[model samples]
Target: MAWYATGTVAVTNGSNVVTGTGTQFITNIKSGDIFIALDNGLLYEVDQIVSATQLTLKREYAGVTNASAVYEIVPTTSNLKTLAQQVTDLIAIYQEIPQSATDAQDAAAAAQGYRDTAKTYQDNAAASASTASGAATTAQGYRDTAKTYQDNAAASASAAATSKSGADTAKSGADSAKAAADASAALAGNWAAQASGTVDGANYSAKYYAMQAAASAASIALPVPITSGGTGATTAAAARTALGVPAIASSNTFSASQTISYSQPLFSINDTSGTGVAVLQFNSNGSMVWQLQKTSASDLNVRRYVSGAFVDVPLSVSNSTGVATLAQRPMFGTATPWDSANLPSVSGRLLNIQVFTSSGTYTPTAGTTKVIVKSVGGGGAGGSTAATSAGQSAVGAGGSSAGYAEVLLTAGFSGVTVTVGAGGTPGAAGANSGNAGGTTSFGTIISCPGGSGGAGGNPSAAAAVNPSAGVVAPTISSGTIINALAGQPAPNALVLVPGSVAISGYGGSGPLGVGGQGRQTTGAGIVGAGYGVGGAGATTSASGAAQIGGAGRQGVLIVYEFA
Candidate 1:
């Protein structure tokens, strides 16, 4: 076969395996066949036929790896010869005939010379025999010499016959080789001619048709016909005309309503000066009635077309800020009560509010442009009252409230770290001071310090005991404060009627929470009621018992996000 190229193949660089797709290697190819890769025009000898779609090459693929590559498999023979090789062999065989013929001629000449020498020796022996009886020995010697010459001649003639036979056999072999070479040439020519079939008229071969197709593609006419899925006209105007569509600037009016929809922006205006305006107008009988205009500043304005001129409607919306201006207030429908809950939210209105009681990262809601942050530090714990003996009394001071701060943050805001302060631990019994509250912060933008703990009360043996001092309010540390306020100080312990009628101080209150009440009898202090509030102090009377202070309330961070 010329070549088996039924399907494509795949090969990897530096690999000996060849994988075929839709190929019939087992049925159409075999070992020792020539494999050619059309991708790189590289040739390889098939080493083994693994399967119908697989084979092995004698050598590894040396070119770039390719998949679904065109290839060919040409059948081969063990002793295949080319035209040059056949001619060379024929010449060699013919050369052998000449050499053999020359050898035969030389042998025949040697034999004739030996025959003449033998005849001369026979004549000399006859002469010697007739001369004398003593010459008889000499004649016999001559005869023996003639006999040796004759034997030599016979041997030479036999050699000539063998040489002649070899020459004839060599000639016949040469003739046969010539005939085989000529037949091979004729067969090759036939195959070549068949591949290059006549290209005249409709009887063109594959190659001829391929060439014609390439030429035609190279010279295709511009502006393909509409039947071929293209506009028949070259220019846009002509094309629109041919499609029976009106031009964008045409004055033709549509008899029926038409809708144009597109996935992308319908159109864009590229204004280099940043001052271009677009307008849409409603007309009746060639006279404009109303018009909507996009101004050079990107603001929208409504206008009424009066007699020979357009008048502004006193209504315009800013595109950059989304702020609207109106000359008159808008009237609301009585059907829906315009309460705070029912009011429609305008642009830049509050979208959501988040309150955090624990430390966490705060992510703004989508489209939030600004956030209002309000933070309060934790409240301080109350002081404990000292234990007293019988007929003695004690009272403790109340804790101070936390600081409060607020800020408005806008621009370049992302994930903000929020930290909520925990409440302070209560003071232990036996005249111990209360623990200070923790600090609250909103990222690095704002921070509020917690309140200080209250002082412990001293045991008094006398009927009149001095009251303990109250706690001070906390301070603000960081932020561009929109509003900041210090917390309220705790109340001092009261000593009415000495040990028997003493009362503990009450805790301080904050913006978000209420303070705890003081104890009047022999008991422990009460805890804070809500966030950012101070705890109440403890008190003891006739019982002379020790009392512990209450814990402070935790701080809070509130975020009001707006667009």
Candidate 2:
């Protein structure tokens, strides 16, 4: 006999069994395999095998366990006639069997092996589907978390970039501060080199360096509070003092670095001709404040102190040499006092006077009167030639000259004569040459006038021929007289009011006369001959030049303090 291998099996009680023609190998079964069946309306599962013919099984009904059951096998037959006959006989015995019982028997026998195998495949498919779903869910969660991390990192990077830019700007400001300090130090060293005095250079140098450091620190926008830097909360005067400024008044609110502007006199000026005065103004904390008037006609610029040194503010103008700037030393403080006891003997000399107080009021002594004389009236032209009918054997008189005088009338001088010199009465226009200007005097003095033109000589008369010389009117004459040689006058002269020495009168234009040899082409009489000059008129002062005028020289103030 050929050896055959067989595996043990346990049959479930409710399962069915059928026989086949070929030997059933049941290849997928293991030692614990079980088969269940219902027979005679009872459930049984083969629990053990003794031999091919007989086996032991457990029987149960309605889910009851541990019932006893025995299995028996018959010899193989082609039609299974023996098993069929047993079933038929049992059915006849139980004539009351229902159709459902018959159908169940038939279906069990037809599909016994296939149903078991199909159930095993279905269960495995369900388990695999559940496992795949879990895996997919887990993968999606990981991806979402990773994306969140990436986005956060990008946001952090952007924030970091912004911070970096801020930091960089702060660093640049620091660098600028450092450079400012270095420049200040170098300036101090240069000052030492140029020092003329035999003082302690080391001490001065140290003071200068300290000031520079403070200023530089203040200029920089430091992140921390600047307790020791240049003045912000502190006043400019305090800062200047701390920086060792020499001899500066403590009452002054400005620093050496700050600009000080001069105020202009309001009422005095030359309507006749010349440059006008512009009030000086200082820029403090980005605002302009009045300073002082220009004493002399000249261009002016602002100066600022940087690191204990004075530097000129950049100025733009034509012909700027000899110009005065704010930072230059010897800034005018106040005016001097007037001394009439020392009356100047010179005819056209000026005597400046100042008021002790800013109000500029003075109670004059009984004998003396003080007033600012703006302009003297023009002297009259001299009389024309005495020749008549083209000079028929007659010599004409020489033309007279004009006179000018400026005086401070005393208290009792109300009787003082005031005569305005008119131009000399023109001679008969046909035969006489133009006459000379007249002399004007207030008291014992006579005013000088313009020189007159000479009479034209006749052809055959053989007489004394007089040639006219161009005359020079007194530059200090009444109606703002002019000298072409003098440039623009000071601020007090052009802008201040009358009766106050604080006010000065402006100089006049070139003398009114014939323009060159073209006598007919002479300009109509006007104050100034230069460009932008205003016509001679009351209340209208000279116009400004392309540049400004010199600062006014300070006046003298003699105070008999009653207080």
Candidate 3:
């Protein structure tokens, strides 16, 4: 039959027995059939079929024991046989073949013929060896003759190379002698060309030019002409007049009120040391009217004569950086100069800050005339849930955030009483609601109310339960409140069946603070962050275990004083 895999089988390690649970081995299996275990993909030959649910393998099972595993039974065919039996059958078939006397005689005749052919080949090989010996002797004599010829050829080649080397040496010597002769002839021709020039010609000899230069240097003319790059005068004053330029003097005194004018720079004063000062002065009737001076390498100053001495002007300039510094402030576009006390101060400058975390008094700083006050009420705490049994869960709702208020106080503001609100207390574990927060006030000028607490959750055993409701926004009341904002409400809590995830509610947010986070699994609630922020709710899934809710944050008041 075809391969049979009707049901699963179980086999043990190092055991030859296989047990089938839902299989029919006795009807489908036999000896020599292949047994295949699907779990380890191993095959074994079936040794015996014990029953409809059991069989035996030829060898022990190699793989680990499997209680239930798929298997296949491949039935043996008639063509299949053992290796030893096939070899025994082949030998029996060979023995059945018979031999005769005539066949034996034919075989002996063939052996005799082969022996005679081998003898003939041996005789022919001996004759060839003798011929090879004779040929080797002749080859040796020829080799000796060729060796003598090679020696004679080598000697002749050596003599020819010696002669070629000598000839090359002679040629090199002749080339050097010719080069020397040519150089000497070129030197003699250059000397003859140089000496051929006469003293009166344009191209004169070097010695002739040297003698002429010596004679000219012996005596120069007393008054050199200007065209020849000379001053054309012997004295300094005469030279100045001839050159059409003024004479220079270290110091001069004029009695006739003389005036000097020039189209270019009249005079230049240079300092060897960089730190030296240079001054230019203007005089009227021998009294200095104004003076300009370079005080340093980078600084310049201008002064006007006053009384008996020169007083500094209010203007100065830096030559290096090109920056100008004015001693006095300049008036712009016909505008009057500003008085020291009437000048405008910087805008939005902060002078001081006052903070109130509890009930206290607020006094303005010495120079504070205006103040900005901000106030916020306290936040409510989260609710707590009771202990839950198996297959039941309890969750609490988050609390609501507080309200915020801001106002500006000016002019008549003075010492005022301040009140900071305290945060609400969280409810104890075991199904309790949280307390409400307190109100904050800034001397009746600004006031804000606190948020409401969250409600506790009831135990639920269904797949899902409705979440707790969120709190409403708190109210704010005050005088001329510039910014009055209502805080955000709490988020809803989620309740789910047993073995599923459940979540607690998250707190609300305020103007200046953030709310607390929600809880998952089983844990206590998280506390609120910063001022006027709500607390987180508690959640639990453990049997007979209750969790506490988070606490709320306190309120705060701030005052910003400006000049």
The best candidate by TM-score is 3
- Residue by residue across 370-466, what tens digits does model 3's lDDT show? 8888777788777787888887777777777778877777754577788888886788897777666678777767777776676675666764542
lDDT of the candidates, in the order given: 0.66, 0.29, 0.64
Task: List candidate 3 segments past 4 Å from native.
Answer: 1-360, 365-370, 425-432, 456-459, 462-478, 485-488, 496-501, 528-530, 542-545, 560-563
Score candidate 1 by lDDT: 0.66
Candidate 1 vs candidate 3: the TM-score winner is 3
Kindly list the per-residue Cα lDDT of model 2 for residues 53-73, writing each as its tens digit.
334444322211223322222
Compare candidates 2 and 3 on lDDT and give the better one: 3
lDDT of residue 347 for candidate 2: 30
TM match of model 2 to true structure: 0.18
TM-scores for all candidates?
0.39, 0.18, 0.41
Global CA lDDT computed for model 3: 0.64
Best candidate, lDDT-wise? Answer: 1
By TM-score, the candidates rank as: 3, 1, 2
Across 370-425, the per-residue lDDT of candidate 1 in tens digits comes to: 87787888888888888887777888777777887777777544687889988877
**Candidate 2 segments whose C-alpha is farther than 4 A from its true place:** 1-369, 372-400, 408-417, 433-439, 443-453, 460-465, 469-563
Lowest-sum lDDT 10-residue window in model 3: 93-102
Ranking the candidates on lDDT from highest down gives 1, 3, 2
